[model samples]
Target chain A: MNRRDLALGKLRGLGNSIIDDVENNMVPSIKVPSRGTSNIVYDEAKRYYVLGDRYGKRSLGNVKQIKKVAQMVSMGNFCKGLVNTEKTATIREMYYVSEGWDVDFSNQDESNLIVEDLEVTMGISREDLGLMPEEDGASVYGDLTLKDDDVEINAIKSGKSGYSISPTIDEIEFLDHGVERVIAVETMGMFHRMVQEKAYKKFNCLIVGLKGQAARATRRFIKRTHDELGLPVYICNDGDPWGFHIAMVIMSGSAKLAHVNHELATPDAKFLGVTASDIINYDLPTDNLKDIDVLRLKELSKDPRYRDEFWQNEIKKMLKIGKKAEQQSFSKYGLEYVVEKYLPEKLDAM
Target chain B: MNRRDLALGKLRGLGNSIIDDVENNMVPSIKVPSRGTSNIVYDEAKRYYVLGDRYGKRSLGNVKQIKKVAQMVSMGNFCKGLVNTEKTATIREMYYVSEGWDVDFSNQDESNLIVEDLEVTMGISREDLGLMPEEDGASVYGDLTLKDDDVEINAIKSGKSGYSISPTIDEIEFLDHGVERVIAVETMGMFHRMVQEKAYKKFNCLIVGLKGQAARATRRFIKRTHDELGLPVYICNDGDPWGFHIAMVIMSGSAKLAHVNHELATPDAKFLGVTASDIINYDLPTDNLKDIDVLRLKELSKDPRYRDEFWQNEIKKMLKIGKKAEQQSFSKYGLEYVVEKYLPEKLDAM
Candidate 1:
């Protein structure tokens, strides 16, 4: 895709709110979510995508199991063939994001649509959502920096009761202070676990939620809290594609932050989770690993700047085994197994 | 994928002393085949991507269908359960794309490789070459229009030998005479159809090759020929991903042209053959489409410019009777069908 194509592709799914997010500079950098309610949720729902996520209640490599659970939840085959008592579920791409076509919606229900018209069902018509070249240079925020500490000051009350969390820089200034590791979790439920879960207590962590106005507000609070506290946050998310992408949002921010040099929420945050590699690390079943997940693991390994010693080591491990581990597999291991076999070994290694 | 990663992704197979036609200067464009007969054939064989022709062969859409045929050939999945064929042959992706352990030997084997990794393939590890992001911004000569006349130059010398067709602009030489719509086919088989098959008698066009070195040489000759004899060249190839990409490469020259905007190719070329939409339109067997194909179709239709009147009207004809038509399906109509439903009916509508 050329620069123009990239720009148009990025411009897709700019709902009034998302467009405003770009205009107002909320996330600083924004990308088409590979996870978390992407546009595919609406249009591609019927197609039954091979979902992958990196989110969950446990930071115990939950970021690595997103694809495993997503495959179970999103694929048509998984719906009928899946094991009845397993913790995993498959989800179609549309379940999490809107890819623009109402895959399940036939033109019969609406007069404006024609079932046979490829453009209509695919949202490719001239007036409607046609395939635009992907947007490349467009910014998520006017000038938000993924690596910058100076977040823009704008308070808008939203959601039920019109509530907003306006934690001033001064109020959250403690986040910028002395700290060793500031790990961030996307769910309060996970937060509850880290503070309470025996496996996660070894490291200093922060947990936050990703849904609703309250969740956004909490995310803002967490960002400020981490910044002021000077904590190096590690993100722990669900073990699915959606969860994996959500953590990335908190980590690198997005392309819009090309201007910012600081205000990074998690500049060095890594994919700390129950990765595919763990499947072999611990004796777990590997049936749920999809080609895409395997593909993603290889891709992450190939990335130059995105490469890290930890990932390099993990890639070496996968190469040795030719397999990956799913975090959902651990759910079967039981909470006791997680605490005993998984966490202690994992924390010590990290 | 980062810059370096993208550079590596495209260099999958580059060898031989053939100069990089797309890039103006010598870059890591071609890998010299090994020093054996097979090696020389393999090295030189890179050029015969598709067969070549001198005038209208098949269209890009048709070329795509051929590519799918190649993919099926490589995988040995063709006619798995086809009528009259009960024997099954399973194929793997690695066969055609040669990936080595923790890495692809084929990718490693190629030399003078100009293009490298892609952003789409970056998520995988090198050990298995499982999945990774395909490299995105490795600059190449063609992909999109960086130079208008470069496309023309390419058109002229596309099928020639012992010459490289580099787009050059002079004071008042070439512009004095603008060209008209002239079709350029990419295969000798397609060329056979024109002369022996009398395919050209049906339309005003040119011919190139459909395979290897001869095809590349034909393209060079086409571009250079057009320069010596200015003629607006329209392309007709297959419609599958590879075919679409080939057309794109010919149109843009390569991403390497990003540096010099003057000699870039043009984008006015038209697609005339089987397309992803045909799966929906012709009601043809869709099992041939890949998982990503559906998503891509959704993306293509969403482009704003595609929604415009001229393009939309042309695309809309596929639904003339609220039904889509596949080029392959036209075969069912047979040679008689070619005279009846195709040609006059099809081209007239277009």
Candidate 2:
């Protein structure tokens, strides 16, 4: 059977079991592996979190559990309906559906938590259930063709207005591309400048805008291009703790999204950045490092994901300098410096 | 000429003045009132801050001022282009345009600040410049036809999915409807339940979901509906500090958006709420009052906007009781009770 059929069959079995439990006067329950640091093991080699044997169950006995089960059933039915109708919805749209289901979700975070719970319980990805989050934080310009469902388009030749990478990366199939490598930028402003300058054409590379932290789709797309086409991926971001974390997320994947990290991370990607050293080397304009920035840098120094010798030294340098430089600070040199000089030098070194 | 034409004309005049300065080798400068507590006076009568006579200038001499002027010019040009093309963009989109203009806005807040600066400088509203933020928070189910731009929508008759209030409130012209009043709810779940029960029809009133903290557009819409339609507006929220502030925002408007407060605030709107007294009087299920909630309540007790004797007493009682109740707690009585009983009783007293 296809993935959709398998997912639908599992859901049907769950529904039947619940019905049987009700008929037999027994409490209907679902057990899934618990999610947390204690129940999750960090695989050093794979650079991702894997679930442990510890399990948690939701049943109709306790008041809170009853509410949770109701939400699960509501979400399950919602997913089943989506599958039957061949429709897709964002997480925000699903949260709105809570209004009709009498489910009280105080915030988007609560709705997201329930979605994760449902995903764990059903042993299915949210993508398979046809639920996507709002597409954001990723833009691309390249000599590439992408087939999203039935529609196919040449992304690079699509003029100055580049393609916005959709959140549903799994549904998209890369057709053909002649790009040698991908240069992913953390800031949208820098990405736009590069695109406007036609830097992608100059370098024969794909330019991906991360916006801030790279979205799952952007990371997944980078991973796919790198793995399938043997394209070297490079990241460029601000010389700050937040920017460092963004690169880490792109390279090793984030712990917060550990469940689907394997499909979303590009471990082979290298940082071609506005690094801590770049602040002095390029003599870029710097802003005073806030207390929070310092704290974050210190925190990253201790993080396993950021334990690389090069990264550790970079954090130490930033802490000592007490200043951070934005990618936009390259504008202080000249408009063309970023696209013409800085990018070329970085890429040549890579 | 229409508002848009007038705005474009003013923008053109400003652009010509800058050109005149540059042509004559004169240092171009634009002066506007400074924004701060020093330049902002709290008008107790209006319950909002009014701009004072303190002025600041963006001139070509100072490097920082030069940068500011460059950003202003970039934004002005972007706005002029949007007007020329008859296109609307969110503040986020405006920030993306920064790259092409060689202007740096590191974050959305910075972009928003620049937008505010442009508004104060040009004496033109952002809406008039064809800019809009993302529409959110408010949902409406009523016997009302709303004319948004070119489209006319009958809100109540638009099936089960009610109309989400558009962010561009100024453009929305409400058509004739027989609804007597508007009941603005803080929670979507409650709003949905009320709509499902057709409680608005029973009471001959409109129901609007604030969806936690009401969006600026929602507030403006409520104010417009109250003033133009001669509808008595009532607010229902949780017996918590956040909920109380939501009512205050609707009534007096928020300090952050003080410049547009007059157009947004509905001072006559009454709080028909899940007040502290309701927990005891209605015997509603209460949660333990959080420390942050208590702190906020204490802070609001001292604020001029929340100086009503009834409101002060309510805050005092909440602190004394050490309990907070969500509007959703009304569900304990039964799904239909909130619609059939609580609302009717509240409206009758009002």
Candidate 3:
């Protein structure tokens, strides 16, 4: 069966199971895998976070659980309808859609949780259930060709701005490309610089602009490019703890959404910096580390995802230097400096 | 001469005039049109804000003005190099690039002011000077065809996600499309819904997602679509002062960016909204107006942009209702209800 059909079956099965419980005069209950940090396990083998054996149950019998149970059932019905109709709604739309339900969500956050609950219980990604994110993924450029349905989009030929990654990335197939590696830059300015200078052609790679902490679709796209297309991924970001965390989120899965890490996390991705060391070596224009930066650096230093000697040393070095720099700081050399000198040097070392 | 040549000539001319002054042992100076609110005027003919007759001067002789004069000259030289090399830099990149110069910018805001200074003095858009904003423009999905250099992109055919507006919008030419009108949406959720439902095909119109306050390129794209392609423009946003203000920014122009309003504003664009009447007539799910929302409504009521009877009534009604609703609030009917019902009603009324 297709992914959509599989998702439909699971949603329907959940609804049927609840109906069966009602017919049998037993309390209908939904078992959701606990997504709390305590139940979140760092899977060393897969190099991503996963839910542990712990599970939570919401039942119709208890007043405390009744509302949640109704919400779960309503969401299941909604997902089934979406898959059946071949229509999709963003998580926000789903919240608004719930207003018509007898058991409606109090807010978007409550509805968002139910969607997560459905995902965990059904063992299906939200995309398969015909739900998408509101924000777009990322901007991509270079020689890569992506096929979505019958339409084929050659990123380089699309336009000077290239292609915006679809929110529902699962539907897109990496058709063909001459690129050997993927270099994801954090800032749009640096990304545009690379595109303008045709850094992809010079380095034989595709450039993905992460546009800040990447949306789930952006991470999925990067993961797919690395695994399905066999392109080694390298991330270039500002020399700061926040940048490191963003890179870490893509490398491992984000702790907040660890349930979908298998599809989103790219463990093999390498970090190409604006590293703390690079800030010192290149003599880039620097900003004094703010209090928040220091706090975040301390926090990441303890994070399991950034526990490696290299990351540990870098974090320490950054704390010692008491400064941070953006990727565009290389523009001090010239506009072409990042693509021509800094990038080539980093990639050569890799 | 072309725009690039025209811009280069202006920059060089300014430089030469300064050189001539210096050769004659006179202090070098540059006159910049004041961009403060007091120096801002509403042009009734153009229906957008324009700079007034007030001017500010920075000369090399005064110790207080030396830093700014040196910075302005350095920026002119930098812009000349960019034009000569056929390169582009973001306002942020220009600040970082300043690090290599004898007269470096202390902060990004200060550098941004210098770019504006050059723009005001030379009467040239920053795009002509090869300076671009870092933010990507809004996403567009429709039958519209855009020609960016040799690449021709049919928005509808691009992918389900559609096309991202290029930051440098001047280079893109609106080719052709089978669309009668353009609808710019404030939220991505509603935008995605319209795209998913093939609302463009159904209504015979193009849909542009503002993704919040419309970016300069997005506004420019909408303006081009309406003026060049003869498509009427309509804006759909939440029933709030902020949303109304965003619509105003697209239609009449933003006061903060008054200098570029000629290129960015669409005076003929109509507001098709989740207005106060719609909130009551449709009985949409709503949130009580926050203190800031009320304050904004009161402030907008006093502004000349919202001086029309329609806007005044809407603003007064919104304050009276003491509540606001999002575009997604229409999803209370169903997922497809927005594209199938609300939009058709609004478009018909227009």
- In order of listing, the candidates' clash counts read 255, 0, 0
Error of 1 at A158 (Å): 20
- Give me the candidate number with maximum lDDT: 3
Q: Against the native chain B, what TM-score does each candidate's chain B reach?
A: 0.38, 0.93, 0.96
Tens-digit lDDT track of model 1 for A148-226? 1232221110100011122111122221222245444433323323322422234333333233112222334445545
Instruction: Report the C-alpha lDDT of model 2 over B1-350, residue by residue, as the tens digit.
Output: 87778879988987998989889999898886677667766678887656667889889888878878888888888788778866555565566546455668786688888888887777667877867664343667789876755556666653333565654566667877889989988866566567657878898888987878888778888988899999999999988999898898899876666666777789999999889988788887677898898889999999878787989999999999999987767755645677778888888887
Worst 10 residues of 2 chain B by lDDT: B158-167
Ranked by TM-score, the better of candidates 2 and 3 is 3
lDDT of 2: 0.76
Q: In order, what are the TM-scores of chain A for the candidates?
A: 0.40, 0.90, 0.97
Tens-digit lDDT string for candidate 2 (A1-350): 86679779878977887999889998888776688878776678887655667888888876778887888788888888877765555575566556556876776688788888877777777877867664442667788887765556555543333465655566677889989889988865666567657788898889987878776667888899898889988888888999888988888887666677777778888998888888889887778899999989999999888777888888899899999988867755544677888988877886
Best by DockQ: 3
Error of 3 at A100 (Å): 1.0
lDDT agreement with native, every candidate: 0.31, 0.76, 0.88
Model 1 alpha-carbon miss at residue B125, Å = 45
Which scores higher on DockQ, 1 or 2? 2
Residue B211 error for model 3, in Å? 0.8
- The TM-score measured for candidate 1 stands at 0.25
Task: Judging by TM-score against the true structure, name the best candidate.
Answer: 3
